[model samples]
Target: MTPDHPKSRRSFSDFLLHLHPRTIPEENLRLTLSWGLGGMAVMLVCLLFLTGILLLLTYQPSTGSAYASIVTLTREVRFGLWIRNIHHWSANLLVVIAMLHLLRIVLTGAFGQGRRLNWIIGLFLLFLLLSANFTGYLLPWDQLAYWAVTICTSMLGYIPVGGLWLQELFRGGAEIGPATLSNFCVLHVAFIPATLFVLLLWHFWLVRRAGGLVQVEHDNPDDVPVQRVPTVPNLIVREAAVGLVLVAFILILAIVWDAPLMEQANPGMSPNPAKAPWYFLGFQELLLHLHPVFASFLWPLLGVAALLWVPFWQDSALPTGVWFGSNSGRRLVIWTATVGALTTLAIILADNLLLQSNAAVAVDTLVTRGLLPTALLIALLVGFYFLLVKGLKYTRAEAVMAGIVLVLVALAVCTIIGVWFRGAEMHLVWL
Candidate 1:
């Protein structure tokens, strides 16, 4: 059919249909496939952008006016509360969806094959999304936003040599003032969004070029290639449905809970036990138990480097894109995850109980916060490395997956502690 046809003009769905293939295999759209996470992330991104634009109309980025503007917008502007709330919730959900999307890829071993480069791209996008959240959250300049940014940037300044310079770059000075707010506002609304859009399109193009989705359930390698369908009616409609549900879910959240806005920022007084945003709480939790250098910089950089190098190490016997790479890989994942979780829990529990019980293990002292935990973490990884190499006799790919699983579990445990179990002064406090 031509563009001028009456059918084409019926609704905006026609234009959207062009973006997807006409049909996909009926099995590909199964809820078990991808869990609709990638689609949900995209939908949330679009929702955030739409609502952000609306919120921007009334928001002023100046430190003096930012909080007041938010108050005005919520109170006086029509549906301003709803729009900002939608943007807020979508931003939160987008982070979660991105993480889950990556988790799915890792679990399915979909990051192997030619999908390796795309995996790196996805990692970059994750950080970009995180940066988006960090910059955007400070716009309100409330006590929560203010103190959170302050603690974070201060922690950054604790990095050894260039830390101060990096922190200064973000702060625009010694403090989070008008200049800092303006810079963050510009980056949040303009540069980051633009770059993310370009990267997202590039990512999709690569996904298509690399072969759409991994056929995880296929049993025979010699069978005829699966017939594909147009993505429009099959995949596109499903995405639309997911988008509607996501929007409705967020709408309900917005109605029941307003986005938090504490009193305007006070430069003279920092909140007791000021916290970082929920996402960074995990790192904050780790920071409290490890040396600043390890907590804030070296450890994170090493993890990234390790992940970046995974695809280069290979075992010909292991086929790529198969879950855990094989049955042996599954065993490795389970063992590593269990070890990691238990080790992580034990370290945190020990620290909370003994950091004060013995003078030798005093909190903030080198032995308690620096030497011990760092050594333990290193030992855990090294032990897992040798375990996979010797006991399991796993391939390099499987070893890598095991290591990834261990790290993910440990980080997740730390995040849980930071988000839920810590209270004033970073002391352990059960919910």
Candidate 2:
């Protein structure tokens, strides 16, 4: 066991080899199974780190010079704009890919059989990924970044208690200022990335320990022997191919689309319809129709809690490792999505009409805008759940899947409205 012994002197490749099992199920190699999302996500994170470091070479975090530095980086430095574009696009794409990866896990029941810890870790990773994006959003010190951050931080004050304290903690005072930018820079560059790196390592290790991706369970397990392939060439080759394609796609996108940069921040002159980042647009859209507490605090909290609860809700009737749990589950998803979208549209239209006609003014704001909508949403979900379970004879798991899909569809619709439909004074505009 001497330090210089051949056995002790493992190469970098050897270390990497040890990170994965000697053999993994051959089925895991199928691209359609996992959709290569997890691998794509890993590639995106690597790109983010690489490009972020390059951008840091010129990015000035100070309020006075941040915007100017960005301008110089994009216009003056060689390949600076491309690097920034890659970082921007990669961050946004990572958010999306991470979410889809989570959804794949849920639909395939990959979180079952003592994998709950990894599921929780995955959820935290998603949250941290979002935090990373939010912190980075402010570094340019542009109007878009400043007001968007302001609106998001202001929403924090809607919490039941200690809301103002939380708001100040993020804002660094009563408003977005010098301290806020410095704090976010430290978080984005030092704390958040460091934490994400550690968590990502842990996540990968857990996946490896769990014997790679979950395989589809056959009805008669003993009838056929499970086939496994060596991890070195089989899994590694597929991963390498995916990484190459992903890198090429990202580079092309970065070249084609430059990251947006608005004028330097002028806090005194807010935009006509200042909005949060697109991810949070669902919440902003909710605020327009509901009370702040429900939109900003309660509904989001509930959604997250439901996600956290997913792994614990076990049903023997539902098959594991199958898309949407079963054929019936797939139909449930379709029905839920269609009904959810139409219902959301109807509600929005009705609410808009009420406001325009001044009919909503007669009721208390809390009742008309907050409690009623919240109660209605709950009732609809609960009623739909029962209908699926009792009337349709679906398993509880399928019912839960329906509920989640419905809520997600509603949120997606709201986000679309917020991003494309909202105009001056946050009013709905067809264009």
Candidate 3:
């Protein structure tokens, strides 16, 4: 048969459909459900891969030549700056999309039942995405990259037992140098990308196996059967449209705003208020108010542990596929978010005031600065849980959700402050 024949077209369509289910629930097609964040992530990853290959053609991943090579590429090579900008912006956008996808899964109770493993896989993918971005950040070999990475690696040293070892492992020495550049280049271009690709495939397969996107349940037996649509034309077309829009958006952004590149890496000089990447700025903000061990190691570890525990703690009675699990869950989120933001801002302001006054000297020790703050956070969370369960009559699942939302709100507030408000000497300065 000729390429344009019906038989040929049908066979080609079948080939495309093989990657997806022949029929998917109509609910899965709703953009409002998943917000197409997962599809956007996949599209961003594809963009990153394409732009990264273009970049690798000229990028010199070495302490001696990296910055000069990037400058030459940006100024001399055809479309080199645009390609680099796309890659840079796409990588950052992937981080945000991955996080939002994860949050969607949690809030909608998509991790319930057999999907727990997929949830864990999603978490790992997020971690790998962050790793990819972090390693790539050092590839530019500019002063901004150098000191930002130095600050982040230094945080790793705050871990109790293997902290210093881990820091040295990544830094390739006691500090960021030639060896560190080489190590990051390899991980960024080869190891991390390869691992992330494999995990992404596994994540997709698991989601398909779990029966597509989760859907709202029907309690009445007489309810009409749920609608279904073919994946080849329906789902694929929607995805393609979304992908094109995302590409257009990123391309416009790439043209409008060039990716930042500062002076060459200088060991002799450090930028005052040298900060970590925007993603890690939340932790950097935390470090200002708490002990390094608590801010850098313990609290982060606990947060991850809490996320991992979410699936197991999920209440079976809570309906899956509904936003916030129920109306109670929605109310809990609203209340938690308001209280959490106010409390976080209050604490930051109070702490800053104390630091500016003689009172800070009295609270400078580990107990007052570290353990006390840690205990207070725990107390607040526990207290909030009880209040929700007892006073508000929320279910256990809703209470867990409240805690998660509160923590997210607090982190967001901290990140915003770190990125925009903090100025010289890490002092809070309204911009």
Listed in order, each prediction's TM-score against the native is: 0.91, 0.95, 0.96
Q: How does residue 6 of candidate 2 score in lDDT?
A: 69
Q: How far is candidate 1 from the true structure (C-alpha RMSD, Å)?
A: 2.9
Model 1, residue 214: what's the lDDT? 64
For model 1, the stretches where C-alpha displacement exceeds 4 angstroms are 1-27, 217-220, 315-339, 359-372
Pairs clashing within candidate 3: none
lDDT (C-alpha, whole model) for all candidates: 0.80, 0.87, 0.88
TM-score of 3: 0.96
Residue-level lDDT of model 3, residues 1-431, one tens digit each, is 68899999998888767557789998889888898899999999999989999999999888999999999999999999999999999999998898889778878878878888998899899999999999999999999999999999999998999999999999999989999999999999999999989998898888889889888888873685878898988999999999999999999999999999999999999998898999999999998888789899989998999888878874822466789887767876887789899989998998899888864364336898889888988898889888878987888877877787789889999999999999999999987
As a whole number from 0 to 100, the lDDT of residue 69 in candidate 3 is: 93
Q: How accurate is candidate 1 locally (lDDT)?
A: 0.80
The superposed Cα distance between candidate 2 and the true structure at residue 278, in angstroms, equals 0.5
The residue pairs in collision within model 2 are none
Worst 10 residues of 2 by lDDT: 359-368
User: On a 0 to 1 TM-score scale, where does candidate 2 land against the true structure?
Assistant: 0.95
Badly placed stretches (over 4 Å) of model 2 are 1-12, 316-318, 359-364
Q: lDDT, candidate 2, residue 67?
A: 96
Which pairs, if any, clash in model 1?
Answer: 21-230, 21-231, 21-232, 22-230, 22-231, 23-229, 23-230, 23-231, 24-229
